[model samples]
Target chain A: MTSSIHPTVRLTSQQRLEGIWNKRTYTIVRLIGEGARGSIYLARIGNRYVALKISQDSSVISAEVNVLKEFKKVQGPPLGPLLLDVDDAYISHDLKLAFYVMEYIDGVPVSDWVKREGLSWLFPISFQLLKKLHKIHQLGYIYGDLKPDNILIDRKTKQARLVDVGGVTALGRAIREYTTWFDRGYWRLGDRRADVTYDLFAFAVCLLSLDPHVTIHNTKERDIYKVLNQAKSLKPLTPILKKALSGQYNNALELKSELGVINRKQLQPTKSNRKTATNPKIDFWPEALGLSSIILVHAGLFYFLFYRI
Target chain B: MHTGTIRQILLITDGCSNQGEDPIKVSSMIAQKGIAVNVIGVLDDDQTEEPVGLSEVNDIANSGNGISRIVYADVLSETVQTVTRQAMTQTIQGFVSKELSQIFGQETNEEDLPPETRGEVQKVVEDLGETVNLQVLILVDTSASMQHKMEAVKDAIDDFILSLQARTGDHYYSIYQFPARNQVVKELLPWTNDGKRVNKVFPKLAAGGITPTGAALKQTVKAFQNVPSSEEWRDDSDDIIDSSYGSSY
Candidate 1:
């Protein structure tokens, strides 16, 4: 695995640009997103552009790097960012920092994109994105911190890139949360992301959140309530990710082989809105109305004849 | 009225700031030059009635960085800054007492636990030993400060569950950790006998939720409902006592 760049409490300005400045590791030309956790920078290596993430804690950095490494080792599924390079090394006695490079498509965060170009444009890409997350689980590392901020969207291509593995745990400490199976040693379904199925659930939540009609801004009461409810209800991955999502389906390769990266007929919403049947029973309606109208006409004819006579 | 020169009177409360006494002003005035007084603004739910008005004081109390919010209880709605600060002083005294006990472990026959409390704890342990229904409902505080604390609790609970299970030699005991949030709003997983499964669920319990002790208790009681209760178990004070007001964690 490529060494990832890590953050530290101590580091000279020059040393901070070790692999970042020079062509040896990366060529960080511009800064990207910044949040409470860390910062992301857009950099270049050879002709390809990449995203670089710099975090504070070493464990966070390790968790992220390990996830990417694990994903790559398992030849991860095709949903999120592909790990390219890393800067996993200590700069000094006091400073423990690390970071890594992702396939940085020149894109903005999906939420920002939603704010910019209304919700109508969210589909296929959003669907593809959720489908990709399922692939991530298949690859076997929980996107421990699954949120809009972590997942970046390529504005031009409308593709989603999954990033940030910091909060993830392969074999980690007790975060003591109560779940159905509370015994020790046995992997609690809540604690670890053993399979891709759970990630699919999260992906579903992500998709529903991105829905144009819905307003899922933060982790507020409404947001959590709606999203978690919607997530638990999602039926299956779109036909694209269906093969891989199925029970008999084994290996991430089968998905790519079955369906290419992009669908030719993109899922864009049109004005001819398909009225999804919400258990509408229209069979008796037309006949009942027509019969009523016929009876009324006949009665009117009979009344007219009787009045004339 | 020489109640011994008060070094620093800390007011750790949820509603003190709301009660016309500005926590920031008070804490700042005390912390500036001479005295080392502190004032804390607890961010508790208003439904509890105790945390009202105090949420507003967070900015001011944390302003000078002199006064810190020491301990804020979940689920109660009363402004408890006064009570909390008083408890804090008591806590300090308790700590000093503990230190003294440690130093004079052999010499001092210290009275730490009240006779009644000791008897209750003894009864709980003894009751636990009797039937081996070792139900360890681990209510972990998943707030930011309690991350390390959670780690400790997980370890302790793990060890405790292991020891208890070893004694009983059955899949009986369980654990349920609650992130500091009220159930009226949202709750994490409820209680279960899945201590073995905690290893996976632990990381999912990240910090950053409001403390809701009532909800936690309600959830805990719900967890207990799954465990088979007996007349022997019902006769104990734990069974007789109501849990709604008791959950301070």
Candidate 2:
């Protein structure tokens, strides 16, 4: 409608782009990904590698740039791709394309990591992700589109890092972008407004999507309960997942605490017998109290047997 | 009443208007009434030549103070959702800019402001977008050339309504078809929050008529003005639907 603003033209390897404002030059290395908004290229400036996203719409580019900048203001483990530069580049004499450069994360999507390493990596990564999401929520923003495609398992830190800042909307705006499978509205659970509950719901849907036994087909007529029932390895998380899907949690931190409980409950068998001895149904304080009492009784017996004798 | 509601008329057409008044003029008038008019040109894949009516789509949207998109039938659903949300954000941003100018005595876009203040303004815009009530009037061109595209149009509207269901604010949607049986426009579905209600109306749509887009849009201006309040709809929704159905056909 606006005369096709250079998104249709694919940049070849070694194509150079210079920022109209910053005047920095970047050499296109290869295309990393492409979505409805634009194409992301792995580009080189000097020896540094950065991911550059080029789009026809200036507003889309600006929105994402602002989110990335906002992400920097929040103190936490890096929640998303680091914003490096924002500018417009002329591809031809007449055509101007909006682009932004960010730190290129070399990691596989969390779903792929799950497929490769097994389901054990699921809960830990999920916990870590929720921690990141909580920090984001504290800043009054929603990771509007929280799906496996946008989350990457950082190869170096082994932490789950969000990649696409495009959907990082300030809390309360309508969700900017979303995949239907991860959207609660599509499942008839909630609206698409950017809120903590919105992200939590999508996070639960994302977890459901990663399970090997669960298949999320593109259908508007899906029963979320039925889909949750189909999960095998993620079955233990079903309760927490339901809580999120039903918009039960107040914030990501609350959901994180609950997910922590489930994660610990799931890992109890692999832990020491003392931890396994603790009842899974009980609260954390009760578990701590039970362990302390066990320690205290053992200490009293050892002192009486050794020192009193 | 505290939240300023954003009203929109989203028109989906596949061809040029061949009947009645000029759609561009009608859209300009609609924009003057503070209602944004967005247009989507649904192009079939087989059409290799520059699709007809693309310029009208752009002109209508531009003069109507909204955005226009030309998308193929396959991706119509995604485009519809994006265009609607983007237009809502733009409308809110326009208001935010006006407020900024009044406060600072300097005209500034959000992007031009420093990061700290910009972030604060953006937050306000986001909150307003979520809290504001929304009413979308969907106008579809059911000309003979658009018969094959009717399915895609229906799916797009269905998805659009589904997307709206996720918002915090109240949403009401109504559907209009141009060139109905012996009329310029027909009310296919009255303003309702239920997305499933479209199912009953979509199947009955026979896409064969002259494209009287201008007349249809003119009728929509009246529809918007006479929209029954939520209370009124709750009282006699069935009657409204029955009467509209009887009159249109």
Candidate 3:
């Protein structure tokens, strides 16, 4: 177990750890990533690939483990990593570390996926993430951190799964951690208390981030407002975004309903076809008539000058 | 990523400028480009005397529209963090207060804000701290006079880094030591988040040579110019200045 003070332990491929609680032997394949909390590793249990999160912060790990334990009991569509096992391992004679293994999610980050698949998937991905948040909110939990990096989308399934559950805050509790760009609290539009609306706000930011046209360089209040106002891609969902940003939406369900409307509107061919068809007609007829009148006037003037003279 | 309004340069020194162009003049030029330049003067603890460059530090900070502080070397580790935090808070507050004035009209004061609004303001400030990719270009003086205070300055810097990380968790630092053996300013470390890596350079940074504060400031400004801003997706009609904005740091 690595001491909580110095949590970063370099692990090599094929290293093994015997789960103290489950007595399951897992072989590490490679390090997937590292964060302030600790490191994540891709490990194998027999033929299955699983994700192992090892951290020296016992309290943080305990909070996540607790949340996952509670979250597992809630019956719904799969929302995040499925907890498989939790245990402690001794790395040295005196050092022991807490770790947990969950179902491995094989997918690229949502932002990368959006870049590959295009903006058409933005609504669906956001809708799915919202649905997940709605479910979590119903279970009395809030995903405190909902950023592009925390969400993974399986390209084949078009399924979005959230990672880094450590920041999950109990409903009505102060949020534990969050990325400032996605956080409404950072925008000076809302507080940090965990609720469905907080997640909705972050979801709105997540959408904005995935939309290549919407660029956010600073989380300053005025700057965020400026970016949101100027984002052409977000024009269709401006009202919803405005409401979400201002903390008007009461719940994820309300936000999801609004996004569903946007989804339907985006998919409707008639509305867009009508727009394209009417624009040229409105623009061309006046120009054509004006040109004809001008030409007639010129011809008449020439005829009068020649015949009258 | 440099799509924001806040840009800052932190200069830490122990002595006056004895070579190169005028420091205050250079600071004013940086200010004209909308970059705030702050100065921290480290004083000798053993001697019962004022730091030689205190007045210049104040002048430079004033010209740059920033803050200046002077502290004994022994107390630098404790005060440096506070000074930097104060500078950042003040810089952000300037923007936030202006915004508040716009929203509530020019007559409004921060104290008169509603409790909920005040809380929101606090969160906004914290958010800016976290989201703003702050690039701190630290200009350290390595003149022979700074030798006695070098150890204390190093410790102070380490504390400053930890405090910054703890407070905002979003900052990138670059170190430029003035009056190198051969060059006017030496790049001790490139931009990085690893404090330990930055600490490694301290032992190797021997304090000697004339203090070319002006040349060092100019070089630091040039370093900032070399960093490319994040590529933005903009329509031709968009007229915002593309030079500085976003989290390019």
Candidate 4:
């Protein structure tokens, strides 16, 4: 209930979230945003800064935590760098809440930066976004929601990274939710999700926000009007994009493709789109080729200093 | 180091995986010498279209996931002298994708919530309001570990996107990626299930860069926006999103 208490920082009660970490520290972070299915935080652990989140309940949180643990086990060093040091311990809070900590982000959202810089955030970072999501999906968990904010783009490196991952919908949850409504589909014991299709839809919404086209609408309906007009607008894919764009057939796949539906493939343009991949005609995310992995390494070092500020 | 060869490799290609762009064949072929069978599928057109890999001796025919069809790749290896030879065959499981999931596996329906439960759900939801539609930001490591997993992730996300389309509410999604270099924001697809021209746009992706997760996160957050709506949304636009240093591993 608005976190019965206020976060130590004057960050305002965006919904104060304070919970226990190791019995000695009861974390207090200002609520930042409502993530996938719960609350997010910009917390202060003693003198250090972190982002925290508490999912709906212990069961759901456990599933996500378990997935996170699996992730901690399998991911490469460059993928979602394991942030939180998860623990199951009794806390200062009355209710036993599931909490995890992550490095605190210090920059403004790309949206604000776009508005501030007054430049199009599209075409540069958008395509690369899909590639990242595809990798996450490969890791065997659905991001459930893929949006700009969930993605943090470093100004120095100009690359994107994913965060706020506590909400992972497993196959069990999907089966539990759909047993009655749909009389079809086989149910697996610990499957991913029966309806991961929704991630694509969210992918579309995320893309539209970055695409300069949807913003031009300037109406309450926003992109809805353009979505309804998909019958006429979406011309055939442009040559190289043809490989990524053309998908499915007459059934729902064709329909999804035709409507410019945002799927994982459609979002991540390949090296051909890069400058010197020999396919110069297709200028996908050119900035990607010129940059180096060193930037993230530096960002890691820089952020360590930035967080201190 | 333990080295094993794959007797047969199966790929599900919905056009995500390149026909001959793979480097896993050596490992697989080596595994073949040990009489190991590996199945890979490259999903073609829809989950049903024929894939080229299905004909590579041990490959199975083209069949997409989510359709309830299964493709089987069986490998048989015979060691002759010091060398080993393998024979591979692919089979398709003829079953409606949904029906294959077995019976009564749907999620439990949310019956009229008991008053207390309803009240609690409503309170949390009300607290969330417009922000209920959270966003997902993706970070992909195009490193050596990223090769085979790339296409699989793309396919899984494609299915996930299709699944989220059924619900209502204003949800928005954006994509950005990094390897050694930074890729641009290729496409911004909005969340509208009207179907026609839905912007199912996946870019032509390949991996080359080192994993730059932190930089990628900053690049993505730079595109984040606070949609103006009358919901209990927390406004940090005034303060804003930051380039937080973090990674999944």
- For lDDT, the strongest prediction is 2
Positional deviation of B94 in candidate 4, in angstroms? 39
Query: Which segments of candidate 2 are over 4 A away from where they belong?
Result: A1-12, A95-98, A218-220, A253-309, B1-7, B13-36, B41-66, B70-77, B89-135, B142-172, B189-215, B218-249
lDDT of 1 by residue, B109-225 (tens): 212333233233333322222222222333444545445445444444444443333332123434344343443222234434455665665666666544443343334433433
Q: What fraction of native interface contacts is shared by candidate 3?
A: 0.00
Per-residue lDDT of model 2, residues A137-190, tens digit only: 888888887889998987876778898876777776667788777777767677
Worst 10 residues of 2 chain A by lDDT: A267-276
The parts of candidate 3 lying over 4 Å away from their true place are A1-6, A218-222, A267-309, B1-249
- Classified by CAPRI criteria, candidate 4 counts as incorrect
Supply DockQ values for each candidate. Answer: 0.02, 0.19, 0.01, 0.01
**For candidate 4, lDDT tens digit of each residue in A142-240?**
565355666666565555555655333332233112210011111111122423443443444454344333342243332333432331212222221
Candidate 1 C-alpha error for residue A227, in Å:
6.2
| Tens-place lDDT digits, model 4, residues B14-111 | 12223222323432332222212222232323434344433331221111111111221110000100010001100111111122233326532111
lDDT of 1 at A9: 28
**Lowest lDDT 10-mer window, candidate 3 chain B?**
B232-241
lDDT by residue (B11-81, candidate 2, tens digit) is 99987888889989998888777788999888888764356557788788888878887878867877889
Q: How does residue B248 of candidate 1 score in lDDT?
A: 21
